[model samples]
Target: MDNMKQLIKQFSALITLSLILTGCVSLPEPIYLTDEEVSIAAKVGITEQQYRVIKTSQLYQLSPRQTDQYLRILHEQEPDLRKRIGRIAEKNIGQPYELYLLGEAPFEPYDSQPLFELSKSDCVVFVEHTYAMGLTDNWGDFFKTLQHIRYNNGEVGVVTRNHFTEYDWNRNNNWLVEDISSIAGENTIKTYEQTINKERFFAKQFGINVPQDNVKTVETYVPNEHIPAVAQYLQTGDFVNLVRSTGKGAWVGHVGIIKVEDNGKVNVIHSASPAVRKEGLLEMAKSFLAETPERFAEGRTATVGFKVLRLHETANDNLKAKFDGNVPPIMMLNRKYEYLTKEQVKTKLALMREQAKKDLIENALEQSKQSDIK
Candidate 1:
């Protein structure tokens, strides 16, 4: 158990018996707690009522193994920011999109709150959580970091949340991420005006008031013709927002992070319809307007266009060193992707459950046990 974590080094060996729980060295089938299995949480400190809520709660779900690996990587691994971002994303691939946050979803067109969950997530939340983890290994720090990245002035709540990517995030979080559509690329840069009816959107969707002047109008995008010109300028870990032209109002249709291969091919990681997947950006560009007259152009099959944005920083030595334009498949995931065979998985899980039972009793017996960090 002493070998399980190195975070609270100040704590004596007394707490070691209470910790040392899990990991994904061989990504095992997640041990979903059945009613009886869930009851085990009581021995670990959580009450039965709390355990039920954990099972049913939308935002409370988190994979102990994945969360552990996330912090572990941040504490010790490649020091490059670009590679770190990719490394964080690999752990979340194929995680089913969780709909529990619809009531308070943050990536909608009009409004959302500064929510955080390391367990399950939708497309935008997927990117948001992954981005947050890239900043630090501590969960305590992850929340505040996410708030700053997701909202204006680092404030939380629906009103402060950045409902739109271009105006909200790109403009506000410039200190965190910069919009390179107009700056980067290998040729002449082209820009366009995008207007969003935020007043109407917020009013109708969230019963909130946004002045007409408050409606974002300074939306800039790299036109279709210039995508290729800017292709070379894109780097791995760069976030791309697929711009769409809906006659109703201005908005972004899809979003994902770019991954540049060693051979110079560019791909993106996103959770679209089926699941979170990494695919070629150019391949999707060819199909944007597949059946329409704009098919041959830069439009995606069901979308209108795209844009490029990279993490912002003045000192980018890590990116310069790591961003050789040759990214590995989802960062260096050789170890994270390791998997256990069925028999080994079962044996491991059984051992884990037995350990859980003993740890809980030891913790309960030691009434003065130190509180576990969240």
Candidate 2:
């Protein structure tokens, strides 16, 4: 019996070597849905064209119409909100990453970039879009919810956009998430204060003025040394802010979401330089910290800690109420409509830009005078 087993093993090794020498072995090809298969999967509201586009693409590649149908089906299959968020995020695991993907385009003509891009996303866009989709069941509601999360008071404009991470983003979306760093890492939590100067930032980045400077805010985070202990308390869909230190101070440099596996392993899902990816929490931290010496020697930033935010139990209900009257077929997307020639639109945009700069300068001057008087 032993001689027969050895012969079989030798024969299998010879066959493998022969195949390798002949170049007959290759990796398995990825399987994608066929056109007819996509047609079969298309629901009532999804068009054949839309279905075809998303047949081999991720969730981000789906059109608004297809999104509505997908969301309905998704909600039916996965009733748990946290799991839904994780699944929706996983669908875009390989989505290309791009910074500054959205702006108030045709709506305001201030930032001429399109309002939405389906192919790529940055860290903030990934998190915001994922949350928006998780909370709504239709495309129109998803758009409205996304707008609410992206801008202050749901106003779509350059100045209203959430620019300051701690000052604007955390404060504006407080209703959706709660800071749980203190509780989750109470034993090893650390706090840092940093000033966010949006006024100077806007002036330098966009050549646009602002009326006020965002004040300093205290942030609580769990230092890298304590991540292992704090990670257990983290649940799926929790927000993660990667904190980095500079000679000046510390700031929230990047962001992502948490997904705890059934096996009790914690992962951080984020969109970075190349694409959306998932990494074990400890593994990511180790990689970041391992490069600290080289990064500091090269005068580059290094991640020092993390701040986690717990999702609110009432997030969906609150957002639904806020978006009660803001869906398509009933909600008006554009503020006003007027047909204009291409040249006319260009002229109007130039005029609007100039007017916006003027208004910002005036507001800054008024605020300066008020500060002087005080």
Candidate 3:
């Protein structure tokens, strides 16, 4: 205790900025630091006094407890993989809700990095964590597998972040997801161009001023009227990404795995705004429209096009492994101190922004061909 204070007094000018840049540590201001906190800060090169916003961050952790029965079903006896996925979500019912998880740096517009926090999570984080847990029994492999699923080409950086439910991840990770949308099938489905407000979205998340050309529009779906047909085909363990209106923020508003009840009722087990929870697929759709009647005018509403995706057995087999329940000791830290390529950043950013224009142009060209025939 005296040793920590002495170091603090000696290096009074050194602020928490150093620790903040590295990752998370204790004490931003000149205050008493506990032995554990002091050790962590010292190990990470974080110590100083200033405006402190310190709190416990629950990431890259094993669950509070993984029951033997849960383990047996998930890792051993469960014959059906979908049921296994639902069971994994069932184990994590009461975990707390955490937001701004990816934004943990001293500098503004916290750079993007692959974060694997399982103790607590928000909606999408909940789904990602559950999937990781369900797949890997070992924490180390879980972190590696998570990186494989969360980024492009399994590379880590701010620009490599994959958030889009329809295009970004769905396009890249064929091993993890099977696209059941109209494009992948022979059937013709209703589709529309969603103009992504990149400026508004990035400004809010990354705190960056984006160019007009950076905004993208892509051919996506509302699926307001067709959720039932889609839901019928969905089974347990299916990854359901609720693509909502752009006015809200990002394209994916909610995410969860499908759970079929004993009585044959199908529900979405997800973590939402208030907390992590489950809802009947039909009920979820009804509530979305009811909450904002003006958004749809007068019509039936379901989750912003419910992106029903199925996980392949090969991916699941590779991801799910035996666990010793040990925390991964080594992780790539010092992300805030690292630099990312601008061209790669812009290329990734522009890919998201321009999807809509390309779709619209193609649609127009098709219409013109029909007009000539008439």
Scored by TM-score, the top model is 2
lDDT of 3 by residue, 1-374 (tens): 99999998768645566776677665555456566555544443335221011212112223423222223323543556566678777766667777755532232235643265556677767776666656765555566666666666555544455656555666666667776655334342445444445444554456454444433445544364566556666777778777766344336666788898888788988876666677898777666656655665644333455667787766754333312333233233434322335665576557655875787699999999999999
Per-residue lDDT of model 2, residues 79-124, tens digit only? 7889889988898898899987888777775467887776789999
Over the full model, what C-alpha lDDT does candidate 1 score relative to the true structure? 0.58
Candidate 1 residues 326-347, lDDT tens each?
A: 3122111111112345565556
Ranking by lDDT: 2, 3, 1
Order of candidate numbers by TM-score, starting with the best: 2, 3, 1
List CA RMSD, all candidates.
25.0, 11.3, 14.4
Q: What is the lDDT of residue 284 in candidate 1?
A: 72
lDDT values, one for every candidate: 0.58, 0.78, 0.58
**N/CA/C clash count, model 1:** 8
Query: Clash number for every model?
Result: 8, 0, 14
